[model samples]
Target: MYLQTTIIAIIMVATFALASWKLKSPEISMVITAIVGALVGGFGFPSRLLVEGMFTYFDVGMIFLTASIFINIYSETGAMNALVRWIVKQFYDRKWLMLVLLGILMIIPGALTGAGSVSIFVVGGLVASVMSYMGFSKRRVAAFIYLFAMLAAVSPPINLWAMLMAAQANMPYVGFNVVLLVPIVIIALFTIVYTGTSKTPERKSKEHILSELPLPPEGMNWFKIITPFAVLLVLILLSKFAAFSIPVLGLPLTFVICAFASAMMDRKRWDVRKWFDVMVKTMDQVFPLLATVISVGALVNIMTATGVRGLLAITFITLPMVFIYITALLFAPFAQGALSYGSAIILGTPIIFLFNSVGLNVTVTAAALSLLFPLGDCLPPSRIVGRLTVETVGYEGSYMSFLKAIAIPWLFMGAIGLLMLIFPNQLDFLVVY
Candidate 1:
């Protein structure tokens, strides 16, 4: 049984690593994954293989695929341009203001949409040109954008994790977010102060900075730019209020709104056929990530199915909570965030249930996980934050310096996390969903 589960874990993780770290094709990875699953079942090499059933594998893929399609559609449409222009123009004159504002903007939409990579890429690319002229360090920008995805993790309206988990618990997401906003804000501000106000030498520019980064072609307007996203926001908020209920269409609904908005925004620049073509370009860049997410889900599902995840559960029992939370805190951005939120829930929930379940204190762990996961999302090679920030901002990918800028800021957050540990009940102030 152990052997069979291990095989699935190996196959699943291998596919994910290949797709992400190595930048391999998703089709190839999926094929490889299915083959491995086939061998595991057909040859009966691992007797326990069947235990990791189809439902687990299929559901993970569906959720991930559905989510990606939504993001993909948005990317293809070019609606993200308005957001870029709006943000750059607002922040160009004030570097510190831009830094804080960028983090805030990233947090709001990202949290609402649960679109981490997509949102970060959009913001990063748009702001790159502006940042280059302004002279912020690469590391600072990288860390800044890295947190860009994270701020969403805790923010309201979107609260993807909360929505996913809340459905199971039958709780109100808005209520949860409202209650925890203070702590989340504290964590977020800590991240901002840590990552935004870096120690790296500030590379202020001598040449007069431009009044604004290049706007999208003449036709784009703020209304056209934000209308789709606004619809999405309204729908989610209405759903929360019982005024309306949104379908569980994952991300497609939002993407559709954005896609049409994209067309509306770029009518002169691109026709329908050309617009659809942009999605293909988007897929070339994004599909692999979806594949990676699905593969990781498969691996984790298999592990849980085959009992390897149970082993990990057993391992968690031996470690002190401090070590667990702190370690997770220090390095989650490299894990690509958002996803780690799930892992922490799966891993931490059990311990909490084991220790004493059924309360908001579980939220602290969730809070701690929330804090850590974004850090993982921003780390390098994966280049979660820096790479996209540099690319989005239209630079030569020199955002490494921005990462250095946040070193001090990270410590400050770390300090806060450490302080939180002293008060056992304070964790409840963090969000669980």
Candidate 2:
């Protein structure tokens, strides 16, 4: 039974990979794979299992939905454009400084919201024009923006993947901050420097660059422009240290408050119909991801029900500890079909348990795994961020260009994962108690 079930699970996984690679629609692939797995395993369609799986991530789906709405309202206020214009004006003559700041700015929305897709549309879209003005190619700008956005999505305070991993391991989400900070800083610096050095043939033309930036609206209120993000950051930080819990999820709550504030501040310009339209479009864009989350839940349920996860764990137990460590690092990047959160919960939970059984620190192992999970965001088939980057930056070329541009950062992050694996003891300082 064990062997047969294991084979069935492997086939199911292979089907998912093939579908994701060939069909390029992880949501469809996962749903289809779940149904097929159920039949093959005599689980008989698994209606309850499918419903349970989808509902498991219902809160996360809410976060994405509300967060997208909030960002849409915020963007409609013209604040994002105003902020970009202000930054360009402040560092108009200092091209390198402007680029560095712009990269950092690109990271903020994702870091705050824990959604790279939101950040890509909110910030990545605006920075494309700025980077172009500074003489960087569209491909390079796209790669840079996408890399930072991914980093922010997984960064501390609100990183969806880290939050899910910590919950799965029964650890506090706050604990990940210490371990994640190092890699985040390292990657951010690398991005800043790389963007600073990238120059186009039009490098020397400050006048041309200035001419290209969109002018902030006449009578633009900087206070209104900064308020929404300010409210969001304060609420998130307070939730972490304050004694009280906010109603609903902290993330969605923060977004709601900010969205309301933004709408009030821009009352004159705000149109309910327009805002609703944008919200609908955002939902349309994010539906695939939301569906993939549900599919992941179903797939994980099927694996657990068939005892495949247990068999896989036992198989790993027989391997040398060192080999197991290396395997986890390598497998981390390809674990997620299309979404990082799904991959973290499904594949990451088991890997953490595997490492814990070997007497390794679960916290350190989980941190390392979490760091490596986002690399999958750049890999082929469902390369979520890669496709988003190309589209947002208006890159005319293939998705491969975005991947190639981000290769160095990807390898750098992978090396960190390997280090955490090989030197868990030395890196034990990163573990939260």
The candidate that achieves the highest TM-score relative to the unseen native structure: 2
Tens digits of per-residue lDDT for model 1, 1-433:
6576666657655655565455434334443454455555344343344334333334433443444444445544455555555655566556567766666656654554454665665455544445545555555555555555655645554544444344323334334564346655776677656644555354444234334444455555667666666766665555556544556543455445545654555466667687567656557655545554444444444445445566656656666656755565544444443233343334544444433342425444444444444555445445444455556544443455555655665555555544553343755544444
Clashing pairs in 2: none
RMSD (Å) of each candidate, 1 decimal: 5.7, 2.6
How large an RMSD does model 1 have?
A: 5.7
lDDT (Cα, tens digit) per residue for candidate 2, span 44-139: 989998888778767777777777778777777777778887787688678767877787777776765677776787878778777776678876
True-structure lDDT of candidate 1: 0.51
Off by over 4 Å in 1: 1-96, 112-115, 153-176, 179-184, 187-212, 243-251, 261-270, 318-327, 330-349, 355-360, 378-405, 413-424, 427-433
Q: Which candidate tops lDDT?
A: 2
Candidate 2 regions off by >4 Å? 204-207, 244-249, 337-340, 431-433
